[model samples]
Every structure is written in structure tokens, then in C-alpha cells.
Target: MIIKIFSLNLRMQGKKTYQEKLFACFSLSERVPKDNFYRQLGGVLDLEYLYGLTRAYYGTSGQESVDPVVFFKLCLVGYLENIISDRKLISHCSMRMDILYFIGYDIDDELPWHSTISRTRQLFPESLFEEVFTKVLALCISKGMVSGHTQAIDSAPVKANASMDSLELKVPKEDLESHLQKIRHISRMDKPHRQAKENKASKTQQTIDANKQELGAIKSRNKNWSKNQDQRPGAGNKGSKYTSNKTHYSPTDPDARISVKLRQSEKTQLYESAKCRHCPPCHHRYSSLPCR
Candidate 1:
């Protein structure tokens, strides 16, 4: 009985090997289900007009650019997938059969280079993008996917690539430690153990951008924040100190500004993209509509 069981176990064990083979009949359209989200989206979204609208942007005598329809579909995929990086978006699309079918690419076809997507985006004007957006919004409205009754504008703090340790004082001559002690009370745990190896911010960025009145307001706020924080439980263990963009700038990323969330003791450096502001309030009013 034991020998028989051992033989059966060996028979069940398997190993996978790599091999390549050509198929006589294979189709992406057939493989993807009818109810797939990309398939449904492709059915409802008609981007054929993009060719005529984008014809003026291209000249008659140069290498052909990326298909405007494909480019816009790629952008839509990126937005729907919440992929911020073009390289990652292309990589993601390559692996998904449904996405490939929606974007009109076969499994064997090579995708456009990620850099090409970036260049094409820069080549197109903002008005073209707005027109595309308007068309999609209009389609949504027609489908009862968006109602014009309510508007929901929302924002969240996205962490910047910079680190808190890379922060530098606006006034170069003032000692950071002495400055912190003067403006706000710091517990032993709140003290920084290390300093940035180098300051990369330009002289202009290091200069104070805030006026005297603004500086005074920030100081007053910092003092009040310290007093309020001391009364909270576990305040002694919190390492974050009140930081304002007016007084400090990130040497690693000059564009990053310091921000903190309500009821959160930790500070974060934030850098919001200008693209988020492109959607006007009038368009946003229909954002709360229900999809049928």
C-alpha cells in the first residue's frame, strides 16, 4: 500500500517547461468576454472624429505621429487605471488582453515607446484635450451617466518625492535648531537626529517669499499649534513640528510645499499637478451623476 501511494505521489508531481508554438487560429476579440469593461467602454465611446479634429496639428511633410485616437484611448486608460506614469501604463496595457483589444492592438504587436506618448502629449495643444473631454462628458450626459444637479470637488494630499529631512530654513544665517526653539517648543523626541547632506535649492528659492505680515501670522499659528498639541495625548512622542511653506523650503524639490492633514501629527511635502485644475466647475457640476 505504501509503495502504491508513493508511486501515485510521484505521478502527480509535475514541472512546467517553456516552449514557443504558432497558432493557426487565434483572436483577441473572441477571447475577451462581451461584458468586459473595456469592451463596453469601446462600444459606447466613438473616437473616430479625433482623426478629423487632429488633422490640423500634423504637417503634410513629416514622419507620421502616433494615432490621435490611440493616444487619447491610452490617456483614458491611464486615467481610469489611476496610473500616473506612462511607462507603467504601457506595460500594464501590454499584459491585459481586454485593454489591447480596446486600444486596437494585437497580442503580437509592439506598443509605442513610453517616451513617444510623452512627446505626443506635449505636441497637442490644451484646446484639443478640452475638446476631447467635452465630447466624452457630453456622451456621458446623453447616457444618463452624469446629472447636472450636484458638484463634488474633492482633493487629497499626495506625498511629494521630497523628504522632510531635506527641508532648509528660509534665512540661511539663522540656526535651524535655535529657530525651532524660538518659534515653537519641541520635545526631546521631536528633535531631528540628522541633517540633509546638501542643499540643492537655488538662491531664489532659499530667499523668503513671504512678507513680514505673513511671517508674523505663521509664527502666531505655530505658537498656538504648539500649545494645543501639548494638551493632546501622546504629544510627547510625536516627532513632527509645525512647518509652514513660508518659513521652510525643500532643498531636494523646490516646488514641494509642506502640508498636514487635520488630526494628523505627521507633516508631508505635497506637489499637486496642474492637470487636476483643468476641469472647470461648470463641468464638475455633473460629476455626481449616476451611471445607468
Candidate 2:
């Protein structure tokens, strides 16, 4: 019998064979287009510089650490994707073939655990991240995306734990709960007398005296409530703690000072004062422009 070989034949054929394999030959990079965003970013970002910065964290002779370049690339992916959760970042990168190609991971390759990304972040200092930011900013400037000459500044005061209407005179530090309890007690005791005076049909000397006493109690209550307004009911969301420049110092910002703005009728407002520490060393104030 003579066997015939035809190399030019092209036809679809079905085979009754059970052939299942664990792996197949594939190229991730070739599957992704050259003009892809991650592809361009990979080419533009020079992550080799990170080696020197990360060298101290690794030892010369131990189990290898996750590649710093890959780690940072993943971080960039998170920012570009606007994914704040690390676990979601890993899952997102894993499912996308283009991202996998950009990160140089094979289809079947398992991604590094999400916890590794957090540990890597804590390992790197802020200064290193700042350095990377500066480089990226320079790149943007080179690309004409940003101009170094002009910058918008914010002159508005930062929101703090204290308020303008809550200013109090500095006094001896005392228990805030105790003060609140005492005020509440006074509130309860004076409630009946104030109500009775209001119910009186005619104004008399005794009623006038009661009215005077009620006014005094209300004045004192308003004064204390202004300083620790956060502690009072209807102040804010439930269980919110109160702090004042007089009784309590800001644990987060100890340098903050208290200032006051006096209004008509002797009403004063308390303000948590802080200066802009990040202002340029030499800047000219443009007072001519009206507030926007």
C-alpha cells in the first residue's frame, strides 16, 4: 500500500479522542497590543532606580523578596484603576490578560498575596515615594502636561475639632463629665421654677425674681454649652467626644492655638488657629482680587 501525503490540505476535522493536558504554549506579551496604556507605562517608567532604594530591605543571601519593580508596577496599576483595596487590586490584575502581560506574569502564575503589597508599602519610607513622585512630575513637565511657574493655593482654614462660637477663657483643667453632670443637674432643678414663672397670669415681684434667676441659669448654661458644644445633645452624630483649647489640648495637633472673634452684643466665637506651614518661602499676597 502506498501512503499519500498532502501538505496543502486545509479542512476542519473532528476527532474522537480524549486528550486533556495541564499546560499549553502561549505568550502573554504577544497577546497584548503595543499601544496599550499599561504597555506604554511599562516602557516609560524606569523602575530599575528603585533597586538602590530597596536594597537595604533585602539581604544578600536569603529567600528572594518580591521584585521591587513588579511591586511598584502593581501599585501604579492600583492608582490607574482607582482600586483602593489591595485584595481587589490583585484580583483585578490577575483576571486581566493585558495587565498580566504588562506585569510579566504568566496566565497560570499565581499573584503575590495582597498582604505583601501592604508590607511593601510600610517598608518603603515616605521620602522614597516623594522621590518617585518628583520623577513622575518631572516627566509630566517634560511632556508639557504641567507648568512649574503657576500654582493654585488654598487660603481657607482647615476644619478642626473646635468651632468659632465655642471659644472659652482658659481655665484650670477640670473633669468634663463632672462639669456636664453639674450643668444637667442645674438644668433639671430650674426646669420646674422656669415653667411656673412662665405660667403665671400676672407679673409680680416674686415672679420677676424667679425670671431673673431663670435668666442667670440660662446664661451660664449657654456659656458652658458653647465651649463644649460637641458634648451636648443635638451637637453632632451620636457619641461624638468634645474637646476645648481650655480644658483639653488637641492630641493630634498640639501646636494649634485658640483665637476669638468678638461680635455685636458681646458674643464671641472661638477658632482653632493654625498657620499655613507649607507656604512658599517668598510669596506676594494679591489682596486686590475679590474672594471667589
Candidate 3:
């Protein structure tokens, strides 16, 4: 109700900031003591508290003027808000009223430039993100926001980090099978999209070689199993002319399965023998999880 009530005198002041308006929305700047709202929002999160926690955990060495917390917070702010691209995120903080306010900046405050963001990220490892994330989640638990209960257990299609088009498949069902066929066709075409992406040559070469190696490993495993097995356990889960990626990559073409097995595990793995695109292939030699 308070958010809908705009206090901006556009005729003179142009507009009140989203941050300011947001604070007003929660009555953060009102007669209620700062402690009351601060308490309600949770706990004190001063610069020292932020920096100390990060400094102790990150264990970085050397002299630096900028606080590590600012860098960490910037990263948190970026990802949590679903602003995935760094450059676009920087641009938002610079121009967007709501972002600047949330990050403790004034309406006309100068936010970090895109280059600053690029440079700051170089200082922290990927672990820093996970560390800070867990801390936040713990706080949610402390506030009784999460139960870690089985009822809370759920699954959603986490699209492969691979482009959506890269996941195309085709089926003979002619009914809805045509839709899958289009997906498969599209994914095949999208392969070159990643190639055009100006990725580092070394990284690209490494990825290509890694995939090739994985394909070989999968082929070898499948060959040995086929020679010994009367039937594959996963084979029972298959539909006519459609093998489930739920366990392995069954291309629209059946022969492709001989060389490339797609194991779609809940472990977030995508193993394609055709190209070695493995999503954290389970490192278990005997982990009872079936191979396609």
C-alpha cells in the first residue's frame, strides 16, 4: 500500500528514488527507530561485519584499499537478482534507481562502472560465492524460513548450461514427436553458435579434447556391457523410437546410442559421447548408479 503512494513532486524534484521510495515503503526512514526495522529485516550488516566475515573466510593476502565485502556484495547482488551478465549488471547499478538504493547508494550516487566490476571479480575465487551464499541461507534457517524437509524436496528442469537449442531431439511419434524433432534439429544447428562466441582458443581446445576423451570412455564402457549383458536395465524405460535422456542421450538415431550415451541424472550431468560435454560426470567406478 505504501509503495503505491508516491511522494515524488515531479513538477520540481523530478522523482524520488526507488531506494528512497523503497525505504519509505517499509517505513525504514520514518518515526520508528532504525533499530526496529533493522531488527525486523534481520540483523546488523555493517561494513566491518561484512568485511570481517569475508576476510576471515576468503583468507586473501596482500594490501588492498577496497573492502572485499563490497566486491562480494556486488557479486551477490548481481546473481541473486538474476542479473547474470556482468556488464549489464554494472550498467544497471549505474543507472537504475532501485539497484543504487538497495546497494546503499543515494539517488544521484555514482555506482561502479562496468570495468570496475570486471576488475573486482578477478580478486575473488568461485568459492567466495558459495561461502557467502551458504551464510545467507543459514540466516534464513535461523529465521525459520526453511525447514530442509522432504516436503520441500522438488525438481525443476534446470536447462543445461548448454544453449537450449543445443538440446534438440526428434521422435517418430508424428503426434508430439514432431516438436521433439524440431528441438533436436535446432540443437544441432546451435552447435556453431557457441563456436562463434569468441571464447578463448585454449579453453575451446581443452573442452573439445575433454569431450572427445569422454566419448571414448563412454563407448568403451558401452561396448564391454553390451558384450556381457542380456539386457540393459535402462532399456526397459524406453518408449518406441524414443530413448529417455532421463538416463542417457538417445539421439533421434538409434546407432548414435552405440557411440554416445546421454545419462540425464539428477546429479546435473550431461554426458554426450558424440562430444565430451559431461556435466560433472560422477567419478564413481562402482557407485551403483546405472550407466545408460
Return the lDDT, model 3, position 86. Answer: 78
What clash pairs does model 1 have? none
What is the alpha-carbon lDDT of model 2 when measured against the actual structure? 0.57
Superposed Cα RMSD, model 1 = 9.9
TM-score winner: 1
Least accurate stretch of 10 residues (summed lDDT) in model 3? 251-260
lDDT head-to-head 1 vs 3, winner:
1
Backbone collisions counted per model:
0, 2, 10
TM-score of each: 0.58, 0.51, 0.39
Q: Which regions in candidate 3 have their CA more than 4 angstroms from the true location? A: 1-47, 53-66, 95-98, 150-292
Candidate 3 lDDT by residue in tens digits, 70-145: 5655676676567878788877667644444445556555666667668666756778667666877777678666
lDDT of 1 by residue, 101-196 (tens): 999999899999999999999989999899899998898888877655554445666778777655655642335456655642332234542345
Cα error, candidate 2, residue 189 (Å): 16
Residue 232 of model 2 has an lDDT of 38
lDDT of 1: 0.74
